[model samples]
Target: MLRKAFMRVFSAHPIETIAACTGLFMIVLGVALGTQHGWVWFWGQVSAVFGASLATLAVVWTVRMRTTETRVAANIDVLARQLETSISQIHKSVKSGRDEQLPPSVYLAQLEQCIDNLIGVSHELGEITGRPMPYDVIEMMTTRHTLQIEAHLAEGKPAPERRLVTETDSCPSCKQTVEFQIGNQPGDSAKPTCEHCGQRFHAHRSTSGSIFLRLPGASQFTRAVSVSCPVCASKIPANIDQAKQHSEARFCFSCGAKVSIDPVSHACTLISKQDKLAGRFDAAGVFHCEKCGEPASVLTSNINGTFGICRKDDALVVLPAAAAQGSPKTDAA
Candidate 1:
């Protein structure tokens, strides 16, 4: 009864702050009268009246605060629905297997949008949970969204087939067959080694197009340097030093190696470091392709991690793997 009457007092017709206060005072007066006229009863009335007034004020504050919270929640719910709709559309478009059909910039833009939505909601959910939200929830949602799109392009994002040119009995580069020397004693017998001295270098041949360096700083559209192809009259720039990590932007487009990229035009300038581009340079680094007896060094971009290989022709190209082989390793996250 107190609650109903208090609410009525609050919402009463012709409501005024002072009139409401007066009604509240009268309600307390009635409670005091009901305890009878004895001195003990009169003191009890006083205590009850004071306690009830304080309780009423607290209830009023709580109700106002809750009502404001309800309005805010309703607005958030509206925005959440919009986020859900956008996510659904993105899911369909990305999974369509026609990324080529979409604009090139679309992928990056859409990915950014998807991430933004996920992040916004994650923060909001964190607020509701009143604790640090687990990263798994956000990760799972994003992973599913990203993977679903890639699934349509490459069969469930399989491990790209990597074909490495391994050391064989016959060197693919020199075609010199390695032979085992006959030794009477096993302990002193050196295992079968490369017959060709210095030419025994392991030349890896994988069409999988290994990308060891990618320049995120490089502008869109392919960049080129002035160099000629050794095999063909391809006027492409080649730089032998492009194999170093610091020289990816200077990588050549024709030979798949790092070159000196022109800062203004984004063109690569050929630099001759061919003395080290053979037989043993990349024995520590990744690239080991030794075409024309010249093994070039390699460079990888830090941001995109696109690998570049140096060429004897003093040119670099986007290191590509064998055409029939699988995709190259990427430093892209």
Candidate 2:
């Protein structure tokens, strides 16, 4: 009797075992049966009790449903409808002696968790690539979720083939490739940090990555060449990141001078009080200019020098050739 009782306790999960023990003990006592109860009946009682516990767990977890499952299920419903229609069309074609070919519905599922771990040198790829966790980490996460959906769908037999749909793509942080397989999660957003450069993957890329501006009622967008931020006194650049980190950037929403870029589309437009003037160009061929600046962006002069407009003070000044050997006015242009 003691041995049978011990076996019962050892065979099941802690909680399930406890419930089985209590319920079984009650059954034997209620029936006034002792150890002599037939083995078949005793085992049958235990199985019944275990089955009840399992049903309870199913309701609590509903572990079958997930985001991927919902989407796949919707697709399945649509496919079923299409299949029915196709079958009807095929029957008509067959009666008329046409080809019996039907369009393909490719169904493939990936299970990422099932992927094996790195064996030798590939495991060290993390440090070499400067990634805290290797690409496999994301691949694993995506696969785990994917496997859950695939397991449920596989029972449907020849799954109605269709292109898979997934949320998110390429990791913004690492710029690393995210490749997933059948029954694996696809893409996810990852934020990376560089300890050496203090650069944040999702943050400013150039201290001037993007910038924009808004006006009271302008349907057409325009760039603000150069303007002042009355509040901070810091110049906000037409480029957002540059203005965010550098003092040379200027932004003032008041009097409608602001620089911002559409976060989603990355389109930038500058809003300024007046046309900008002043310009410079580097060897790489990138142009730097203001409206007034835009025209003077390139140094186009005749006779070796010309008078350009005073930049901030709104005055014009002459660009003279090398100070006449003995000239007192000696300012480098």
Candidate 3:
């Protein structure tokens, strides 16, 4: 126990330990001198050793403080350099995006990467300075850039006027009707918090330029039908509105081919290959039309069976489904 205590004390106070050892050696030498001469000489040596130890402690503490300050200054310099580099990268990305007219998604991704680097630097600076990093400014700038990207993606078109949409169904949390505003373009989305129970709602615009609202846990009540893809013959699970008996187009995960299925009989028909189309699916599985390159919308009825609809300029083009054993037809609407 004594050895461990001595080790702890020596590790915590190395200058004190050295001074103690020196004082003990001087005391032993004084005892030997006292045996030869007098005890008064030993007491004088003890007082001198005590004063010298205090002087050593003060000198050591000053040196330690200076070393700590130097290290801290060096760390701050490195962090500042890192922050400057991140900002430079952001500027370069923005300049290239403007010059090349990059796609909105690509530009937004690059900007986000730069912002992440800056945020990392900010966190390190906060740790070194012992202050909280203010993220409000960063968040505001990100939101502004995102909105600008969204506008650019809209192809210079003014966004549709905002309008309140009341949910037809009640909220799952409180069983109260929720109303939210949606002003997103054909490819954007909005998330609004529920007033009654604080639940969040997602509002998305489809490729066909239709807006739809989704409530939490709403998918559990949705019905799905299994059908085989006409292109790859792979099984695809497609969602359908049971009450309205409406079916929408779905992409086959196996072959990446868009197929339309009948809600009643689950008859699948090929619409077009994903590579030949210019659209993307949002998080809610709703397609967003980037360009009307081909017939991409699905229409199914008792008489028409399954067909694809495409909008080109001012006219509507109808494309008959490519069934396994039937001739395809094309019509203009």
Q: What is the C-alpha lDDT of each candidate?
A: 0.40, 0.33, 0.51
Clashing pairs in 3: none
Instruction: Score residue 115 of candidate 3 by CA lDDT.
Output: 56
Candidate 1 least-lDDT 10 residues: 205-214
Q: Best candidate, TM-score-wise?
A: 3
Query: What lDDT tens digits, residue by residue, belong to model 1 across residues 84-111?
Result: 8557746744652153322212233344
Backbone clash total, candidate 3 = 0
Better of 1 and 3 by lDDT: 3
What's the count of clashing pairs in each model shown?
43, 39, 0
Model 2: CA > 4 A from native: 1-38, 56-63, 66-68, 71-333
| TM-score of every candidate | 0.31, 0.17, 0.33
Q: Which model, 2 or 3, shows the larger lDDT?
A: 3
Q: Which stretches of candidate 3 lie over 4 Å from their true place?
A: 1-43, 59-63, 137-333
lDDT (C-alpha) at residue 296 in model 2: 22
**Model 2 C-alpha lDDT per residue in residues 12-67, reported as the tens digit of each score:** 34555455456555555534433446875576666555555654553333333344
Deviation (Å) of 131 in candidate 3: 3.7
